[model samples]
Target: MTKTIIFDFGNVFINLDIEGAIKHTFNSFKIDALSEEMTAFNSFYEQGLISTKEFIEFYVENFPNISKEEIIDIWNFMLKDFPKHRLEFLKQLKATSKYKLILLSNTNELHIDSIKKTIPFYDEFKNYFDAFYLSHEINLRKPNKDIFDFVLTENKLIANECLFIDDNEDNCKTSKFLGIKTWHINPKTEDITNLFKLKSELFN
Candidate 1:
């Protein structure tokens, strides 16, 4: 019996354009691909091990030509829009009260700020959730196991009774390893416009 639904914010809720961001960064930096150090820095940033200032400074110092503002823009270009239909679907789900809803997103402050501006109803959507866990706020991230453990312990939820939904396969796999049921959502392949269709068993 699934009593809780854990949702991933990016892609699952709002669209993410990672490729576009990468292309924009490459054009700005005139680089073919990200350096090994940059990749490590990003991982640290995502894990909340490094502050946004530290992350930005590290890149600016390495790439002197790239302005801080430009870096911030490129970094935030990954975020797109939140469709009204998905918001309606979530609102309906919240009304059901059949399962506890939680949002677990691996995102930074800048991204969240950008999202709030783009989606004027961000707070209203957040209010619908039983818990909203942002990686930077919690100082933990997905695929680390610690974060999932924290959610499970904090919510007093049994892994078997929670279904985790994430766009990232690795995150879903980690949750599954912890005995939680998972739906590895592929935004390109699966349209969340009709989430109830995606998991009818829950409603049935």
Candidate 2:
């Protein structure tokens, strides 16, 4: 039986328009694609190695014409609407108290600030989780074995007894490697609200 449930934040709980955001940023910046250096910087920022000020400064320096506020807006373009039903489902799930609910997300401070502003019930939604591990706070990101190991070690959880749900296949792949059961949720066609109904076999 699954004793612990790990949930990914973006695309699992909250929706993200990654493609749209990229397009908007490219259009605004007059660039075809983000440079390798720029991508690396973003990854570093997500890992909490760089501060938000540093993140914005990188963009501002690269795009000399862009202001700090514009850079922030562009960076936050990926976050989209968070449906209420998902939160309700989670609340109900937590009410059961059957499994330890943990939230593991590769998120930055600015993204979280944006989430709070966009999702009115963000605080209530967060209350359902027993452990909330943000990449920025934990200094670890998904798709890396270290992060998974940390989670298991920190919670004193056996890998086989944990179920991780993530929108990204790479993240799920690492979890599976560690012997953790995972559901690589397709946000386009699948809704996390159907967790129990869809994964009934897991519970049994």
Show the lowest summed lDDT stretch of 10 residues, model 2. 195-204
lDDT of 1: 0.88
lDDT of 1 by residue, 101-202 (tens): 999999987788788888999999899999999988888898889999999999999999998999898999899999998888889898666666777775
Candidate 2: where are CA atoms >4 Å away? none
Clashing pairs in 1: none
Tens-place lDDT digits, model 2, residues 1-204? 899999999999999999999999999999999899999999999999999999998999999999999988998999999999999999999999899999999999999999989889999999999999999998999899999999999999999889999999999999999999999999999999998878877654
Quantify all predictions' global Cα lDDT against the true fold. Answer: 0.88, 0.93
Give the clashing pairs for model 2. Answer: none
Best by lDDT: 2
Instruction: For each candidate in turn, give its C-alpha RMSD to the true structure in angstroms.
Output: 1.5, 0.9
